[model samples]
Target: MLFLKPPGVYAPQDDTSLLTTALHEEPLAPGARVLDLCTGTGALALAAARRGARVTAVDTSRLAVLTCRLNARLAGARVRALRGDLLGAVPDERFDLVLSNPPYVPSPHPQLPRRGRARAWEAGRDGRALLDRICSEVADRLRPGGVVLIVQSAFSGVAPTLDALVRTGLDAQVADRRYVPFGPRLRERAAWLRTQGLVAAGVEKEELVVIRGEAAL
Candidate 1:
């Protein structure tokens, strides 16, 4: 489905495509509840809706929320797009599946961006700021047997994510991985990332991994 990406809204990129592919592989039943956190253009949400699941998409950016809503309408898919942060968007909702392609690029700054295009990728130093929160809180948002598919850079510590999810009582593992060339942001941060030991010197590519965590029945 074609999505309208306005200025400041994150366009669907490698990580997004990878997560969407993983979402398609899941055994989603009709009317199953699904939530797409940090949803940018509602790509995964729309994908689930196309498969007959009820979908809700949440993002921290207003532009992202608007873009997702518009894209959902154009695709003739039902999606509830809301502007809010992580699990806080739908506090009372539980889902059979949760999808997120959140910001995972480690930034030089410790504080996250409050607005602008940077919010799409400028994660705090170590890059696990949002990833950690999601791992810790998402299980509570899942119905028994529900699953979450989250894509993040291997630079952001994939093993820790799996460990956290397991600590939450979910069966977790690395579901998919792809080596993608550094994007403009990562390329710009290459020197800094090297200095921080997050990447090897002269490395121009990063490994992205999709971690799948399934809530126990």
Candidate 2:
């Protein structure tokens, strides 16, 4: 499907593809409700819509919301695109499937970026600023027998994510993993990552993992 990403909006990348692949593996019932958090360019949302799911795409960035809406239009897909903080925009709604490729790159800053391109990829120091919130709050927004698929780098503590979901009464596991070379941001922070012991000496690649959590039946 055709997608247009503006300057500050994130383009569909490896994480997005990984989550989309996992989405296809799900046994979605007819007219399943799907929520795409951090829906940059609306790629995943459109994918779900193509499968006849009612899709909602959410992002905090106005540019991202606009990009997603435009992409959905271009794909001839029906998607409700909204601008709000993660999970905040859909408090009154529940979904059968929730997909997110949230910011998981460990950054030197202790706080998330308020604006700019970095906002698309910069999480807190350990990259869990947004992730932790998702794990803790997403369960409440999931319908019974629903599922959530989230993609993050191994550097951001995959075990914690699994444990978090489990604590929320969901059965969770790693649905997919891909070893990818460090991108420009991660490469630039290689030294810091090494200092923090997140990567082994001379390591230039990281594993991207898609974590799937299923709500109780």
Candidate lDDT (C-alpha), each: 0.92, 0.93
User: Per-residue lDDT tens digits of candidate 1, residues 1-217?
Assistant: 4669787988889998899899989998889999999998888888899999999999999888998999999999899998898999899889999999999989999999898899998889999999999999999999999999999999999889999999999999999999999999999889999988888877899899999999989
TM-score of 2: 0.98
Which 10-residue span in candidate 2 carries the lowest summed lDDT?
1-10
Where does candidate 1 stray beyond 4 Å?
A: none
Q: List the residue pairs that clash in candidate 1.
A: none
TM-score of each: 0.98, 0.98
| Model 2 misplacement above 4 A | none
